[model samples]
Target: MRALGPLALAVLVMLPRLTSAQFGLLDDGLTVQTGREVHGRWASVLHLIPETGRFFPAYWLTYSVIWSVVGTRPLAFFVVNAAVLASLLAMLAHLVRLAGDTRVAVTIAAVAFALSGPAVESFYTLSKAEPLQLAWIALSLLCTATAAARARGSLGRAGWTAGAGVALLFAHATKETSVVLAPIALGWLVIERRAKPGHPCAARFAASYLGVAIVSAAAFAVLRWRYAALPLGEGWYTRAYAFDAATVGPALFRIMAWLVRDFAFLLPLVAVGLVRDRTRGPLLYASIWMLGWLAVYLPWPATFEYYLLPFTLGAAWVAGIVVGDLWRDRAVTPLAWPTLTACALLWVSAGINAAADARVQLVVDRANGQLVDVLGGLPRDSRVALNMSPINEYHFELPMHLVEMKRRPDIAFVRPTTAPGHQGETFLVTPEMANPPRPTVRIALHEAAVRQDRAMLDGLIASGAAERVYETTQRVGILEFGIGRLLCRVAVAPILDPTYCPTERGLIERRTFTYGWQVHRLVHARPIAATMRHGG
Candidate 1:
């Protein structure tokens, strides 16, 4: 047990370094940037609005206040995250003590998850809300579980239930998926009640849990209503990633593959725990919470790695039970050797993960430094239009939401058009290709232009409309002759050019719209336009 404590400490120390590669410390960067914007009293970008209370001023203010006092360095953020994770570990250790085998429980929980790829990804990546959400979830679980072990009718049970409820709201606000644990927490309270009939503690716990649930749900409803983000009346099809089952199946398969690759070691342990305790309500609740989330996620077309984060706690708990059971099994011959082998495997995996994680940290630091360089060069209060969504980069630090470039009438490289006829006086930009995916947000521009009922090519080439012309480089720039308004759109992802429209070659050859803001051939840049930056 003593050795395990030191081992866990070592893992915690190394976790931050290991998990930094793929995701980087994104949340901190985002929060810090957002905090600066907040301090500056600027309105957040439309996309940056919080749908839940978790990201509201209260939570952000806490982070901002901490930053003000401690200085806004990455290390400060890392320390906070590390401390939260360590506290969760300590809570798990307390649970182990409650279960009466501190050593085995601690080993099982720590080994199964701390070294898993998901844990590394969720905890190490700073920009993601997952770690913070998970921390609150863990705290909630710990509080509820501790209350569950007490004798029925204990006087203090109500407080623990209230604490769990508060934590639940915090978690929910942090991430919507954290709601999956509600049923589990409720079941924990219910099961505990069965052992202490007529006990005031049991009733109070149940009441408190129910109260918390109602309050959290109400608060969320109010928030969503305020933001007009309520799911009500919005068909499932309206969701960003909700797709038909046929499409969802393939995406689900990919997500499953990712899970397998990242969680190979813990899978067996979780399976064993589930198979052995199918009827235990808490166990079943955990399994249901996990499987239920997977089922729900399977139908989403836009599932990402961060979506799998909330399940880490449930998975770790099950893994711990499975490992403890495996250790106690008499049928397993040479138990010492098997246990030692497992430990060694976990240690090696942890070490390899840690090294890889350090490399990730290096990438994140480099990216962050470069991003700061980019922002620093921009003049203060510059009406900068981001050609792309800044959130795509794990460690991107642009104050995109607060830039107020939307009102400046510059070509918003993203989509370049709003709703129908909302293209404003600014020229709406579009790829010459006929079909553009929603992923590019090019659909919005195309749809809007179509709604305007303009002959596509003719509108682009019309007098006062933007004229297609060549630029100095290979990048294409529309030169408006009639009106002084010309738009140059640049795509910077996996570079795409009309020349490579694989599905439709003729779409680019057609000429319809002439570039100009006026009615006829009018003004042109001193030189003819030629080149356009291909969308990456």
Candidate 2:
């Protein structure tokens, strides 16, 4: 257990080094210009304006304040993240001690937490508040459980348990996902009630939990009032798909595959968790918590592997309890040292693999730095469209700053023919532009001249209507194309063979939608001609 202090210290030291890594970048860094006009240190800038009702203002405020002082530098971000994770681990260690054998239980849980590779992405790279949130949840659970264990004629202890409920509510408000902990809170109340007949502490527990719930609800309502008439739950993203039993098969497989890829070292804990279905005391409580969380989250769209943090903590606690019990009972004698040695070896290997993976991601982030430079250099108002994934994936943090400054970029980079009827006119290629009733122009560029395979940018240039501005590594070339000098010669030029189409239609499809988005070449082909004939 003493070793945890040094191990934690080392983790704290390594955290700052990672801040400069890709994972260290956060939305708070980019919100510098409009950080105050929007809202001070709240995530007000992250969402579209008319924003309201994001839970746990405290969480974002803390992060934003730190980010404001630190700037967007990665190292600074890493330091904060490291501190949060270290605190979380220390809390978990304390919880393990409260539950069972200090050494074995704490050691196994620590090994599992440290060995799990995906946690590296969740805790280190993302720099999300989830680590801190989980720490609070663990601490709350520990406090409440400790109180329950001592619930022998003490209303004050129940009041202490109520404080734990308040903390849990704070955790949930920080992230909607922490709502899973509510079941545990309710379960604790039920267990306490059953154990004590007409227990005065029951009343205190109910009042405290109810008080926390009311306060949490009020906080949510206030947040919603800032955004819209409707509750925050009415948002579209919440309606996205999650997982159910039918979907669970695939989700389960996915979780397993991810574990194999990133968490090969923690296979023992996973195996133990699965094999030992029936545990007693808090171990049982931890097991139920894990299963309950999986059931609740498995079917929701929130199944991003990082959502497994709470479950991972619960499982680690359970593993620690089970192993520690074995060590104490002498049922697992003689082989204890051997088992611990093997786990230690796996722990060392896991750390090495995690570090290596982080290094690879660091290199990839560096390579992508070129894209960031190009995107940043573009006119703030001119949209630099992306064709592959949503631009938000790459520029999630950067764009919030742009939007908050009321500098909405006009350029929307999207694939043509993405919509069914709104083709050709809105998208660039087709005969509609060839003899357009109104003036339009075609822009052309060599595919290789773009220097990088940015198809969205290349396609925009190739359409011939855009004035060409080509740049090599060192120099930029600007070609002027005014309306009078340019000819609107939109013709059907195929970009892709239709054999790739899922519908199997045999036709060469030119991409759709024109530059200004004023024309969908095929759909408005007739209307545009009428306007041109009238000279309107």
Q: Please provide TM-scores, in order, for all candidate models, with all chains considered together.
A: 0.60, 0.60
Judge candidate 1 against the unseen true structure and give its global Cα lDDT, from 0 to 1: 0.45
lDDT: worst 10-residue window of model 1: 479-488
**What tens digits encode model 1's per-residue C-alpha lDDT throughout 1-536?**
65456345645655545444221223455565566666644333212443422233335554655555555555556666566666666665565554445367667776555655455555555555666777776677567655655665676666676687778777766656555454644654566566435445435444455556666766755664565343533534335445465546555554554444344455445444545532143355456556655665665555554566556556666556556666666366345345545544644443343334333334334444443343333333332222222123321333431232112223232222222333222222222222221111101123233333334435435534354332111112221111000011232222222212223222112212211111111133221111222121
Model 1 error, position 466 (Å): 27
Best candidate, TM-score: 2
After best superposition, candidate 1 residue 215: deviation in angstroms?
4.7
lDDT of 2: 0.46
lDDT (Cα, tens digit) per residue for candidate 2, span 1-536:
46467257537545534644542224433434433443553555334322243445545555557656775555666666666666666777777775446676776777666545445545555346577678667667555555655656688666667677667666765666666555655665555455435445444444445445455555545554664433545545554444444455445544443333333434454444344433344554565577666766555532344566777777667667766655564454555455545555655654554454344334334333333444444543333322222223333543443343234454333333333343222322111111110111111211222222244334444554333332212111212111111111221122121111223211212222211111112222222221111110
